[model samples]
Target: MTYSKLNISTPSLIINKNNLLSNINKMNNFSKKNKINIRPHSKSHKMIKIAKTQLKYGACGICVATLYEAEKMVENKIKGVLLTTPITNIKDKVRLKNLFKLSDSFMIVIDNIYSINFLSNIVKPLRKKINVLVDCDIMYIGKNKISRTGARSIKEIISLAKIINQNKYMNFRGITAYAGDIQHINNYNKRSNEAKVRYNYLKNIIISLKNNNLDPEIISGGGTGSHELDAKSKLFTELQPGSYIFNDVEYNNVSIYKSNNKHFSPALIIGTSVISRINKKQYVVDAGLKAISADSNLMPLPIEPTPIGTKYSFLGDEHGKITLPKSSKIELSLGDKVYIQPAHCDPTINLYDKCLILDENKSIKTWNIDARGYG
Candidate 1:
């Protein structure tokens, strides 16, 4: 039997087939037009099917946030997996060893020499060479105090490069300097300007590395917010943008391009059913903090009973409060399903074990979130 959105169970994560394909093609075309390798971050959607779609649309590889995510991709026979975070835990070292044995093109990001040594020790004993990138902090002193990850100075990066190169098991792939804080800045001019600063900073680091006889062929790191700027910089050989596949409310608010553009669309939604009606204007939904993520501080918008001025508020883990104007024309009774556009797609997706895949014909399928809860 064919299924539409109405047939899906409540508190389910849904992916719009048309919008998801549109998003994938847009980013793929954008990277192709710019001559950049798009390694779409798999951390956002964590589904093997979505990751495969990205590769089909011309993604060079997949970028994962955790080692477990990398393992999932490798298990699915996906090559070119890059772990974007530093792994220091001894417990995960064995898994890292197996990961290297599984995929021929696996790399890990590192900020300091300690992690380098940690990984080198494991790869050395296994008689394997692991590609590693230096994570550079592009934030300038006194400008952006917030630190995400990466080496603080060119000297330190150079030092780390020396150590990585000296080790027989480590292959210095390149540098990944991402200005993550500037990604969410509201103004386009401000975001672009800051990204330019980061680009210049990273360029200097690359120049220093070249001068030191160490060249970084893979200068990677960019998010959905800074893809345009990063692609134009001509500095990054690889662009890692995760959330472009499924734009969220927080991303839409600061989107450099308008949301109306078909390049990116809000394809992911949480389907919730009205469980209680307090009054004509207020109703409670079955999905709240547990079903939809609240980490972005933005509330999910009602898309089904999408009456103008309809607002959503989290009542608790299992309940959501949706309020409409007293004179609203749209009407809904208990058990009516309402689609909620998530504020943040990454953490929101992690909440669910599987997603209802909605196609253009209104037929639905299921895609397991293989990497969910692994990280």
Candidate 2:
């Protein structure tokens, strides 16, 4: 249906069904053609419907960022759930024991020998093996001072893999290294080149692992921004790109979007209302720091129903201001609604408990953001 048909509260999270499905199909089509598996990251949507939809579109399974996310996926009967982060807490280790027992296809990523030994102790009593992968640090080391997780070097990753293989309670499934830092690089050539560098590094690691008889069956990494070159590289057995389903402003700037007859579009958005107006050039909407997330210090852009060249910024915790150009003659009255494209998709989606999903047949449905919070 249309935007006006979405009858919901102010600053509500909205999903365009056609756009969402198109994105899923596009990613799936690319992976299938390239002969690689796609494991869509559930952290972006964190809902049952979206996960199931991805599986329906031929996704191998789902990738979760937290233990809670894995629990929810297994609890709902979603199989082949891969925990991509190296969880450290003892309580979560305990949680993993239960979660593993529920789904034999469950797996986790680890980068340390201590984590392996600790998990081995936890899983010893279960009488079952917990599957795991080695998180490799593929992010550019010299590019930034702050570091991302994974084994810092190939030697360390091999050592971690060996420990996992030796541990009776753990099964060494594969290696995972997400270049998250490069996902939003504005230049396609630079992003592709950097990803290739990481790919070559990983290839050498695989050779080393094979030499040690620790050959991994799975090599998982890649994001939405580098999907085009990622599938072509023929390195990653399965790709995990979360934000493709919901094209946010950050992705809009960095990602090399294909605008053919079929492609991904900005499906997830915030619908806000013009609560107050300062003049013809400026107005206040109900969404702000609370409604839209500012994780990368990125501001939301005004989607249609709002004019072009309109700017949006967080005014306060509960409000956002939108300013128009000086020459613009458009004047929005009070109570008028505006649909905005959020800057960051993942955390912005977590702010809401439910989203208003609009269908092509003018149907408005609400879906719970099942894995919405830290819990």
Candidate 3:
């Protein structure tokens, strides 16, 4: 169904198709030129259409954060599904085994021997080899340790690799060393240096693994913030940068190589309507915590009818306050729509079931968030 700007409903997620294509093409070209593989993370959009487009534009595979996302991708015939998180529970393991049987190529990350043993026992009976990548924590040490799921040291990483190589039902595909803390440092030089530390650690782990005669086919880990650094390091064979497809306000703050450039444009926004006016300068929007996420502690930026010097603030679960200049020329009626850029795209996209794909001519198409609410 085609929709014009005026007719679009409020509190709807909008995707500028032109900007989306531009981001996809730019990242794809970067990966090609650098001779590295991009497994664009599907957790950002969770739509099979975007996944297909990513693969069409030279992505080697798709990275899913959950088994449910992987199942959806495999069901749609998308090849090479990688579950970036490990499955520890029995029920999830059973589901993973089932997915392994159904998918042409299926993979998961393992940070410890317990997960490896658990996975090995389940797949051993089926005689099916499940591709496994060791998750390595290569980020800097914090006061209370970085709260991420991965092997904390080089020894643990190599030990996990050894277990995977020894398991008959598992294939040591590579390593995943993503620095969530360093991804949004807001300083290019410092972020690159921190990423370099992680890269060196990843290299050392690889060397130790090879010393034990274990060769990894793919080293997967990288985000939108460190994509350039990862590509330049020439260490990782596979790079997973999810949020680049839909650049949000959170990623917009990072000062990486192509971040400030037009290479990646903000394509995702929530089309909200101004419902109430408080005084002459302040108004309430339809989007709030329930509609668009404010977990990043940043308010949504107004896009459509973007008046200069307007500010958005979260009021409550069902309402958001926008302050406009009293002397501004932009007039807003009760039903005027205000498109807002989400602070964090991943979780914000999860709040909606479908995304409104705005075409180049400003028409709209509907793309279902097929992997939405999937664990």
Using all chains and alpha carbons, the TM-scores for the candidates as numbered come to: 0.95, 0.96, 0.95
Measured by TM-score, how close is model 3 to the native structure? 0.95
Clash pairs, candidate 3, are none
Model 3 per-residue lDDT tens digits across residues 122-211: 787687788888988776453235758888887787788887887778788888877777777878888887777777777888888888
Ranking by lDDT: 2, 1, 3
Q: Write the per-residue lDDT of candidate 2 for residues 282-374, one digit (tens) a residue.
A: 899999889999776778999776678888988989999999866677788898888899999999999999998888885889999999877
RMSD of each: 2.2, 1.8, 2.2
For model 3, how many clashes? Answer: 0
Off by over 4 Å in 3: 1-4, 140-144, 258-260
Superposed model 2: Cα runs more than 4 Å off: 140-142, 255-263
Candidate 1 lDDT tens digits, 1-375: 122237867899989888899989998888889999999899998889999999999999999999889999999988789888899899888998999888879989999878987988888777878899888888643266778778899999999988888889889898887777877886777787777777777888999999998999898888888888788788989988888888888887785653334336889988888899998888999998899998887778776546767889999989999898777976678888778899889999999999988887777899999998854
lDDT of 2 at 151: 90
How high is the lDDT of residue 337 in model 3? 78
